[model samples]
Target chain A: MSHGLASRAGRISAQIGIVVAIFLFWEVAVQTGMANARVLPPPSLVLPRAVAMLGDPVVLYNLWITSAQVLLAFVLVAPIGIAIGLLLGESDYFGRAFKPFFFFLASVPKSVFLPVFILAFGIGFTQKVAFGMFQAIFVLVISAIAAAESVSSDFLKTARAYGASRRQLYLDIYLPAMLPVIVEGLRLGMIFNITGVLFAEMYVSRAGLGHLVSTWGMSFQMVNLFAGILLAAALSIAVNEALRWYENKVGAWRG
Target chain B: MSMRTAGGNDDRSGWILLLKNPLVLRLACLGMILAFWEIAPRMGWVSPVMLAPLSATVISGVTDFGVFARNLGVTFGSLALALLIALGGGGAVGLLLGSVRPLRTTLLPIMSSIYAVPLVVVYPVFTAWAGIGVESKVLFGGLYGFFPMLLATAAGVRTVDGGYMVAARSMGATRFQMIRHIMLPAALPSIMSGVRIGSAMTAIGVVVAEMMAATAGIGFLITQNRTMFNTAEVYFGVFLVVVLAGTIDWAVSVIERRAGSSYPRKVRTL
Candidate 1:
């Protein structure tokens, strides 16, 4: 047991070691003029720039815009996507019939439709939220349909046999049962939604993290650009960890 | 006989019983959805300026075939080249890593973490390195395709049944014989599924990269038309992408299904 733990610790350290090694190499390259600072900024430069930029109102607002779009996307799409899934998933006929629509939508890059979304909802926060939600809706609906279909008829029959109320039946039985798949779908939905919103902002928006990325590119501020990219990466990772925590929490709640 | 079995067990010849197939029936179900897209604008159920009539989009496509065809050809070229690089390089790396326990333990988690990041947003970095054109698109698409294929290949290799390996070893089976008779067939399904997902994502990544900034590509065409508010042309471009991406997805799905049928999955893969 001790040996196993040691090896596990060794493996983790190796992972960390590699990441540090890469950064160290980058810093050395920048210092030695082996790499162009104008094109790619090292961590030594980017971290300080990122810290300074965090105090700027525009940077903070852009960050908020990106985060809010992700939040709005999940808030708007989750229930609607699940509802649509339930509506269509209740019947096998409807499920098969609508499968093609889901397939086509899911396969296509939702970012390309950014213009359509901007036109429909305008270039404000609404457009970003709508675009993110649109991509997520397909993912959630597909998962929801699968979850609904997987609910055993025997359980429903037993509940009905016991004269369970409609709300109680769904709350006590269906919700708990399907939480895993639902959370999984939600995670997948959110990841793509985040990407979709970022892509939309980069393509056309006047403000947001993605826009900041473009702005930095135009001004040739490699330090700020690298920092922006890193910040976005950190945001994505944070969101991912949050969702995973929620999934585990749901599992515990059921237990 | 089941409707599927009656269709010949293989979908290719199975179409001889096409009328009896569930696949066809499901496709038939999509007709109304397609019709809604086509007729909604024409019938003024939606704004004509917003959504073009399907026929109008097609007419635009035909009329401006030169522009559409050129962009499409370039996009396809980039995608094809990207997939080829991904399959060859990623497949080898994933195979080696999966078969080696220490490597898998060290690398797989890092790959998984990187996978969740919005790699597409790093397009500026790629453009800076490779410049804004086919090279950048191909690289973006290739990286997108590479991760999935690698992860899948690793998962496939690791999940091979130990019992089979043990039996082969005991029987004095040579390494080549063991791989050919046992490893290849056993891991084929997971590898095929990886390829399936890789192809789909490659199409998406390439198109989106093109859309973001491009001198020539289908996505560029769509963007140009949209900027001018030429609704029909934009619609046509989107339609072409839908058809192209959908076709690639469908074709890969068929291959994955067939490749996976020979060996059932023992471990769940993402």
Candidate 2:
């Protein structure tokens, strides 16, 4: 086998070894009575509970609702962020005008606005979506604006000198330059989106993973609660990995 | 030359003119928002029950500020304790792990996964294990804050130029001396950034803990208000949280700027 293939194999083996070791240790801890299953439920118990939760329609419905809110919030944030960023990037006057206001809004803990949102939109998807959007939009806008700002002035000048139309300038110069940053903003936006949706669900939701966890907690179902948490972590990691793959693909094209 | 100088002066004046020109326009925008919010209810544009006018919310929030301040104190105290523990413990562990490549490779992933774990889920466990009080909140906050601190410090240590250490060794510097003089200084920026992020995380952890189960803190106030459907008080609690977060963020930025200035000229220039 080639050296690279051998190393890849070795790495996979190492990862498997680590996973096995962790489980072994955990199982041993439970069996030996070193760790209380009440507080820290062994993976044996937690895994089955998680699988059972997957079978539940209510759990699935909640997950769907939360995911839908996240997607909707991202849709709301991405376009506005790009538009504001483009405008801010294109004009020194606009940048100076809005920078401080953006900073102020960004620094405000978005959780504070949850009540305001619920008040305005009521305790439903609207409130959750608004909370998620508020959490994400500021970061996206700032990152996009920064990206836009970094587009070389020389490139713009050259485009203008070549009699390029404004539309062509934007399409050719700005979009290509800002795409990576916009992707990065989306990645961060997803984090905020997930957190916001979950928080909202926790605050006043009839269903969702947050609701599941809260319900399990209130009922002292430690195993189920642990299972829900593990699922959430797994979901977040999966989303993050997918984004990283996309980012790498985009970055390669940029390179 | 004199004409060109006069034109430069004109440019400066024009910039100042532009700066001063936006104040009224900005204030007008804010006024417009307030007016709309106020009149919309009166004009049936929105439900009065849903949103109290700005005046009423502000008055109620002010009246409730004493209780809010006490809760704020508890939250901030918990945050401070968490910060101290995370920085000290994480910094030490980071330094150790960073110096040993094998340890770093083996442990970094574990640290990161712990960091990424939806800490909110673990809140109940913490409450159960540590009891429902400030101690649980502190531990939860510290755990949330710890990962970033360790990651940042390790990153900082790794990024320190090998040349600096080599040169220091050639000059007969001890390991302790190198760490104190070289590593610490070089790592300050990353460490500060970690602390800043940690500060935010700590606040979130504390608030989440309090919301889950706690007797006192701004988060408890929010929870209490929410339960009572006292929307105004809920907003008031939120406003206090925003203020507290903003203050911590602003303070970190100021300190970072000052620290940045004190870095070596080459590093600062970079």
Candidate 3:
């Protein structure tokens, strides 16, 4: 146990050392003119600006807008995607007809339809939400179907034999068995949700994190651009970690 | 749903079989969508200004085939270049990390955290660095494809059987020979899967970068047409993108399948 703890400690220090080394390299390269400071600002500048952006009401508002759009899209996604997935999983004919379609849709970057959404919905909050929904639904539906399909037929049979009603069977048996995988899907879908909203914003938006970063880049505000990108990255990582934590907690029963 | 039951009687009649076949049903569904597309604008269900009829879209695609071909060449050329860089760099780094436990332990977590961040958000930074040209697009796509390959290669390396390593070491094989003959073959399936995902991601990165801001490419064509209210051209560009994406996915799946089939799946025996 002590040896394991020591190795983990070493690993943690190594991680920190590596991050510091990277920053040092960036600073040295910029200072030495080996790297263009204009394009690649040193961490010294970017980090401070990132911290400042955190306190900036304008930046906070943009972050909130992007987050709200993603959350709204996910809310719409869960029920509709789950219902469709359950239907596809339970009905053989539906599975045969739609599974491949959804699979194809999942692989194909649904962002190609951003222009259509922009044209139809206009470049506003609705457009971003709609785009996020389009991007996330296929991923959620596919996972939900897989989750449903993973439950054993024998389990369902036993539950029905026990006089479990349809709703009870779903609530008690199907849901518990499927929740872990569905949660996994939700985690993955959330990434797409973030991506979709950000992409729409980047392409065209009056206010959002994506717009801030893109606009900063265009105007050659290197520090702000890097900070915006870093902020976005931090947000994504945080959300990803939270979902992962939830997945582990919920899936503990699977062990 | 009721019509799906037509095959339950096992009548073996051609008409009933045709009606009941899953493939036919799938095709019929697609046909319905195409029919709807063809009729929706003309029937005034949706304004023609927003959506063009399927016939018009197809005609636009055919007439502007030269322009489409040129832009497609640009997109594919950049994708090819980007994939080459991603494979070389990511594969080398992955191999090194996979072979070294200390490095893997220290770096993998950091890399994955960075990976979780949608790299698309960083495209603007690339544009700032490399300009809104093929260079930035290539760089963006290359970065997008890099993580999948690296992670997969490392995961694959871990899966190499201990017996294989022991057998190689007992044969007095050099480290290079052992890696080339055993580790690489063992890792082929995982690497191929990575390639499948990486290629798709590379395409997405390039297309999205172009869509966001670009001088030329299929994605640019779609956006440019959208700006000009050339709805038919926009649809045509979208059609091409779908076809391009589908073709790449199909091609990679074939390669992955071939690689996967080379090694018999492991089965436990008492």
The candidate maximizing DockQ is: 3
What's the TM-score of chain A alone for every prediction?
0.85, 0.87, 0.89
**Candidate 1 TM-score, C-alpha based:** 0.85
Predictions in order: lDDT: 0.82, 0.77, 0.86
Q: Please give, as one word, the docking class of candidate 2.
A: acceptable
Candidate 3: stretches off by over 4 Å: A1-6, A153-172, B1-25, B257-270
Each candidate: RMSD to true structure?
Answer: 6.3, 4.7, 3.3
- Candidate 1 reaches a DockQ of 0.43
Candidate 3 Cα deviation (angstroms), residue A55: 1.3
Give the alpha carbon lDDT tens digit for every residue of B1-270 in model 3: 454455546556675577666767788889999999999999999988778999999999999999999999999988898888677778878888887878888898788777789777888888877888999889988998899888888888877787888878998999999888788888887777778788878888888989988999999999999998898998889888889988988998887778767766562221
User: What is the C-alpha lDDT profile of model 2 across A85-168, one tens digit per residue?
Assistant: 777766765665676778678766676566667767878888888889888888888887888877778888999999999899
TM-score, prediction 3? 0.91
Q: State the DockQ of every prediction.
A: 0.43, 0.43, 0.66
Among all windows of 10 consecutive residues in model 3 chain B, the one with the lowest summed lDDT is B261-270
Number of the top-ranking candidate, with lDDT as the measure: 3
